[model samples]
Target chain A: MTQIYNFSAGPAVLPKEVLQQAAAEMLDWHGSGMSVMEMSHRGAEFMSILETALADLRELLAVPDNYKILFMQGGALAENAIIPMNLVGRKPQPATIDFVHTGSWTAKSINEAKKYANVRIAAAAPDGRFHAVPKRAGWNLHRDAAYLHVCTNETIDGVEYHFNPDAGDVPIVADMSSHILSRVIDVAKYGVIFAGAQKNIGPAGLTIVIVREDLLGHALPCCPSAFDWKIVAEHGSMYNTPPTYAIYIAGLVFQWLKRQGGVAAMEQRNIAKASLLYDYLDASAFYRNEIAKDSRSRMNVPFFLRDESLNEAFLVGAKAHGLLQLKGHKSVGGMRASLYNAMPIEGVQALVDYLKEFEQKYG
Target chain B: MTQIYNFSAGPAVLPKEVLQQAAAEMLDWHGSGMSVMEMSHRGAEFMSILETALADLRELLAVPDNYKILFMQGGALAENAIIPMNLVGRKPQPATIDFVHTGSWTAKSINEAKKYANVRIAAAAPDGRFHAVPKRAGWNLHRDAAYLHVCTNETIDGVEYHFNPDAGDVPIVADMSSHILSRVIDVAKYGVIFAGAQKNIGPAGLTIVIVREDLLGHALPCCPSAFDWKIVAEHGSMYNTPPTYAIYIAGLVFQWLKRQGGVAAMEQRNIAKASLLYDYLDASAFYRNEIAKDSRSRMNVPFFLRDESLNEAFLVGAKAHGLLQLKGHKSVGGMRASLYNAMPIEGVQALVDYLKEFEQKYG
Candidate 1:
């Protein structure tokens, strides 16, 4: 079989060792005589898995003691509405939610919030293109806004926030879906941080929400009991039947992250991997990545071919060389290579070599 | 290696073959060089898995063409809130919804729906105990009810509906989480059928919603877009990233069901399994099942030891014999042996033999 490297944006590549361990334990977990999938979520076996996962994730991110980690379903897309429902209740009726519309994800968040609150676009990309994060200085934040929502890493547009914006006394709700565990950050800086687990975490079904303790228990009357963060935190995320198998896989990934010396080590490797590919793309005239240097994402790198007609041939040759899912998102018709933490430097090098070869063949 | 039988209520046992196949494909699915967990939901490879699973499920259930199958997250508990949000919009503001509260599951649904609509208990067990389903003849369903909700099989109460309730022009929305696909039923009779995939289906985190076409677009303004049935059906459950891995396992289970001669054959096996266990409980003075004979669930059998002191010893002996997770739910403390579609008759026989042995040793 040919060597393969996957580059799908979310539900992307995972550590091979993690997959192997999951496969090995698929039938019976640690002599329990039941597969992890077969164990009841309330059982000791699955409880241990859930606790360990939560602990490892907290330690890796250095989450403050005041923050609660919640394991939820429906991903970030659902959280778009859940956030407003849970947070807007703390403010007055017809609460205004401040949003920094950096890219596609924030746009979705802003639109979903409109159903629950009066949404204010605090700042947006001046060019109407998602190539850069709008400057924080220009943001027209509302003093009485419920919360400031931002997509710290725009998965589709390949834009990222390198620094945390100061929101004064207001809380910051950041959607860190794509670049969550790929780097280390101060967990205390944000009022709430949420990510769909498919990208840098585990599977698509599981979502991780980290919110401060003070942010609990103000959900609107319409909030689903299961999605109410306070109720979920109080029950240790078992208020409803959680995604047990997905949580188990995520626990395994957390263990894998620890074995690799935790998130800091993974971040260094991610940076090196992203640098290798970005450097090659910058030096090549045949390929161009249009995003500003400082704003570009280390996790997802979307680029275009100088001659657009060679796009299909470039993808065909890339696949022949065992590079897979390199096509950009439909919203942006180009090529994208995601350098998530699980992606090794060798995969990046192979793709760089392929890029050089493809440009030479079609120049 | 003990020959173990898992009797977990939810996050329950799956077919051995399904687990083995999933293990084999954990690293790479069908030579795609990516685990199903690692594939994008929009990509062809994952799409194929989703489509095949949906098709297999439709075939096995004989779902009508007018009904749309939606793959969602948050389990049946979340669906408790989601159901009212999607249905109550059909009627005017302060819509009245009717419910047949036979057991714990329906009680929970009634409480959740009260958040969105005015809930009326159309019929309930005359006695407070959940021993039997309320007969349809006694139902005082509202003529203008948005829908009448029923729990076909209450996992905790072990009460099963042996006959479909007639609601006239009012639609019947059944929560078939624990007994779906174990028997044949006419799909056209109900407006919506929802089940959490942890009982008769696959793992938790994936919920299946089968709704008639006319029930699709009545979502309330506050309904989360990801859980909106109309939006989900339009995008084929890809409006938000689905629980992809769970769906894949469910598909495998569907295939396993097909190989076992579909739901009709499973119904025969289930009848035999339930009969063997129920007969033993009835004949033995040491054991008793409280559920009415006509309403006893074929999937979940909750029984009690006449001498409650021997409960610990019975469980210990059962575990020693590899009959695992036989403890009853906390709400009803005794024992529950869930004989889902994946459980073979041999496992039931083993449990029966153990019950006899335990009774003889301590009677």
Candidate 2:
């Protein structure tokens, strides 16, 4: 097998150990003579897998007792609409929601929320640069809004919130899609925190939503029952046929995370990896990362070559060097290297070496 | 490795060959040096896999040019609400939806649809006894309904529709969750056919929806953009990050189905398999099936022993004999053998032999 590191933004690289264990258990999971894929979601074997995954995730994130974790499908994009649909009914008909438009994701959250509520852009990073999060104090939140929403980490723009904003009495709903497990958090601060599993958790199909107990039964009449937090919580996320195999794999990833010393250890490694690449990009004239230093994402770092002509050659060479998916999102044309919990420091070192080699040849 | 037969209703048994190929390629799919799980959904590798899957499924069903096959998330339960959210906009506000309440799944669909539309129970099977599909002549369908909804196969009831009822000009939406690939049908007859990929297909999470082209762009304002069929179709089902790994497995299953001679050949096998078990049950004094003979599901056969006390012993001995998941739904206390596309005739024979042995010993 080739020694390779994948840098795709999402549906991205998973740990080799996880993949190996999954492969070993593909035909017959734990001598049960049935693959995880073949087990009924309601069966004893799968229920235990789901329970363990939920528990491990709670332990890793130090989630508060007030929160209920929901394993759902459809990713962060779906959450954009689901959040508003589930929350807006907290107020009267045509309720309002406050949003901090940090980047592409929150901007999207605002647009989707508008379909279900009266959206007030509480704060927005200046210009279309998407390089920084607006200061917490700068937000002009609605006094009695249904919820204040924010995208803590922007996968495309490389911006991330360093501080949790105080929304007073209103609950804050944060979309932590990209950098969810990269740092420690006070789960008590936000009313809800959601992350699509592709980046740091497990797979794309599973969307993890952590909500306070009070936030459960208030979904709007138009909210689909399967997506209604109350129904999902009551069924233990089995209101619908859940992404069972993905949940099983996520449980395995959670166990793997615990084995690697939980979220605290993961954060330290993420900081080290992010710094190594950012320091090199800042020091070099050949490449530049545009996001504000303090607001830059530790999970996804998008940088550009000083000269545009060498871009194709850079990616081609990177692939040959066993580096892959360096191309940035089409919406933001450049390159991005996502260093998730599954990504090791060794992978970062190799990426740095490749950057230097490519610069020496073309700088 | 122990050879086991899985009789689970869903997340059910897959073809042995498919599992073997999947296990062999789990670490590195098709020499790509990346597990299918690790591939980027937008990348060429996964795109090729997705394209082939759609092409193969279309070929297998002989799907028409006007119908688009959408690979979605959230399963059929979610689609119950999603359907009304998308179609009600085509008519006046609070559009009426006519439903046939035959069994558990249809009742669920009707309840979910009520949240989005004015639901009319066009027909009902009495006292929750799912012994038969209500005859079409007895249905009191709303003349101005937005759509007529039916569950082609009731997984819990062990009942199936053997005929398609006309809805005048109103489109028909069929929840074919448990029996989708077990038979061939005319695609043009229905406006939409939706199924969760836990049975006959491949894993859960991935949902298959075949909808006519005209049903595309009528989603109500309350409909989540991610669940909106028009927006989803336009984005190639990538409005949200899809269930990439599940889709890949489904593609594999579709390829496997093709090798076993498409839906037509599989239908013949299913008919024979259903006949074998049903004939034996009818001939025996110890066992009985309650579903109407004409409407009995070819995919799920639920039978009860005359001596209910023997149930535990029967299951315990069956498990020891390598037959698994024969316990019927808790709501219906009996045994069900789900003969999906993956169940070989040999496995059916084995179950039949066990039934005969048990009856002889207990009689």
Cα lDDT tens digits for candidate 2, A312-353: 999999999888889988888889999888888888999999
Write down the TM-score for model 2.
0.98
In the range B107-199, model 2's lDDT, one tens digit per residue, is: 899898988789888988866677999898999988799999999999988999999767888999999999998899988899999999998
lDDT scores in order: 0.93, 0.90
DockQ of each: 0.91, 0.78
**Candidate 1, residue B359: how far the Cα is off, in Å:** 0.8
Off by over 4 Å in 1: none
Best by lDDT: 1
Per-residue lDDT tens digits of candidate 1, residues A1-363? 799998889889999999999999999999998888899999899999999999999999999999999999999999999999999999989899999999999989988999999998899989899888888789998889999999999999999998887688899999999999888888888999999999998988999999999999999999999999999999999999999989998888888999999988988898899899999999999999989988989999999998999999999988898899999999998999998988889999999999988878777
- Please state the error at residue A258 of candidate 2 in Å: 0.8
The whole-model C-alpha lDDT of candidate 1 against the native structure comes to: 0.93
TM-score of chain B of each: 0.99, 0.98
